[model samples]
Target: MTVPAAPFTPAPMPERVTIYEVGPRDGLQNESAVVPVAVKAEMITRLLDAGLPVIEATSFVHPKWVPQLADAAELMGLLVDRIGDAARRMPVLVPNEKGLDRALDLGLEHVAVFGSATETFAQKNLNRSYDEQFAMFEPTVRRARDAGMDVRGYLSMCFGDPWEGAVPVEQVVRAGVRLLEMGAGQLSLGDTIGVATAGHVQAMVAAFAEAGVGVDRLAMHFHDTYGQALANTHAALQVGVTTFDASAGGLGGCPYAKSATGNLATEDLVWMLRGLGVETGVDLDAVVDTTVFMADALGKSPASAVARALAGA
Candidate 1:
């Protein structure tokens, strides 16, 4: 076979980007069967070895709500013992003050809280109204900040909501600004149903910039239900957003939003970034191998295009 060469020019993007791995928490939560805690620990270990800087270890949400991660405490204990102080780089999601208390007891230094931009999702996910959700997060963020923990605020349904059709950019910005004002060090905007296109992403980020939210404090979390996650990511990169939320093997979806699908695959993102001459500090081969291992554990093939192609090869 003759090798065909395709010449390309790279787009202007950040020199180095941070991949916030969310497979262990967000990915596993939607699993129908509960994954063994040991398997979860090994997965995180493998991802860390693959050079993912910040991995979401688990969620402190009630077991009744997310039973998949019911072993949050035990998993964190094992991870801390195995990785030592590197556990500081692993952030856990906290739903409320109770969740924050659980994380604090673990000596965890990093945490995140999930918020919704739409009223219906807020009621379904958090059981609070749009404006009322802030009250729920206020104390948790305040106490976390007091403990010197870096709190990340996740604003879901930034582009579209299932209950409500398209979300206004102004609505997302207003909700996101409140999270930052509540002491969240970073704000991750979520395209919850994966209905966002590249233009919508650019406009959303631009709106945030107009509201005085710098790119440094923003992260993009895209879902590939419509096969638009990577394209949306490229749009984000064009605007200088340096952090992205991805799941190993593309193994995450929103449990609350039934229409939501798997997250942007870390391997796919790494492949694109490598091709673009962007630095992400990720080992592509290691990530593919890890995804294969996890796929065996789950009895499902990886959803990542890169992982599927590399594994078959």
Candidate 2:
């Protein structure tokens, strides 16, 4: 008697996924060479053309910290008209009250504030203790929300940190809860150092769920340094996280973490999501074309597999 093998069943996933494109902000922030405002505007326009519903346009951080994004105000001015589009959003990073003020002055309606779960990263990045960092975020979040702006919070090093070996899942959940309570409409869990494994991702998401933070209020941001980003994203998807952050052409890395590489590439995420029959409303071919154009401007080839394959084909 010949035994028939069972059919392989794909894991259940969300019917539609929302990709938060962070290439213009996070991606360009790490570049050693500064990109022109015109080029940055073009990238944003092309991303919108590719149908990305949410794009992080720029950061209001101090130039001393990230000179690559020094033209943040200028960039915002260039996109002032597009900011009025109701179908899409352009969220800018506001580090504190000062950053928030700059964003508000530009009439920006959406903003993101960032914090870290690990003490070392908080100290290194913000030059403050974890508690102090949250204190800073409180007023920023309050003011931003009071101004009627949609606020998103980013909790970095949620799974692992370079200084701290492995982060406890509870620590990340606590940070996320605090951020959500502080008035963040959405929270993004970041693997700042690219040390997250699929198991770590699952455990972290489960921990958040246990804390009463639903998957609807959360997003995933992974780095490809260990080549585990896609695997980790799969773990997140299985847990019902529909929003994932990606950088077009895999453009950025953490300057604070030297070993950290580019983010999970937008093209790669779209490729996986499309194969899973998940809808992202992103045109993969158009995204690849944008990346190809960006790579030429940056004088390098794209870091995404899909972009490379498409370019070759």
Give the best candidate by TM-score: 1
What 10-residue stretch in candidate 2 is worst by lDDT?
1-10
Cα error, residue 217 of model 2, in Å, equals: 0.8
- Write down the lDDT of every candidate, Cα atoms only: 0.92, 0.89
Stretches off by above 4 angstroms in model 1 are 1-9
Q: Write the per-residue lDDT of candidate 1 for residues 43-77, one digit (tens) a residue.
A: 99999999999999999999998889899999999
What TM-score fits each model?
Answer: 0.97, 0.95
Evaluate residue 87 in candidate 2 and report its C-alpha lDDT on the 0 to 100 scale.
19
**Runs with alpha carbons beyond 4 Å of true place in candidate 2:** 1-9, 82-88
Poorest stretch of ten by lDDT in candidate 1 = 1-10
> What would the per-residue lDDT of candidate 2 be over residues 75-168, giving only the tens digit for each residue?
8887875545531248999999999999888778899998999899999899889999999999999999999999999999887888887888
lDDT of 2 at 176: 87
On the 0 to 100 scale, the lDDT of residue 123 in model 2 is 95
Per-residue lDDT for 140 in model 2?
A: 96
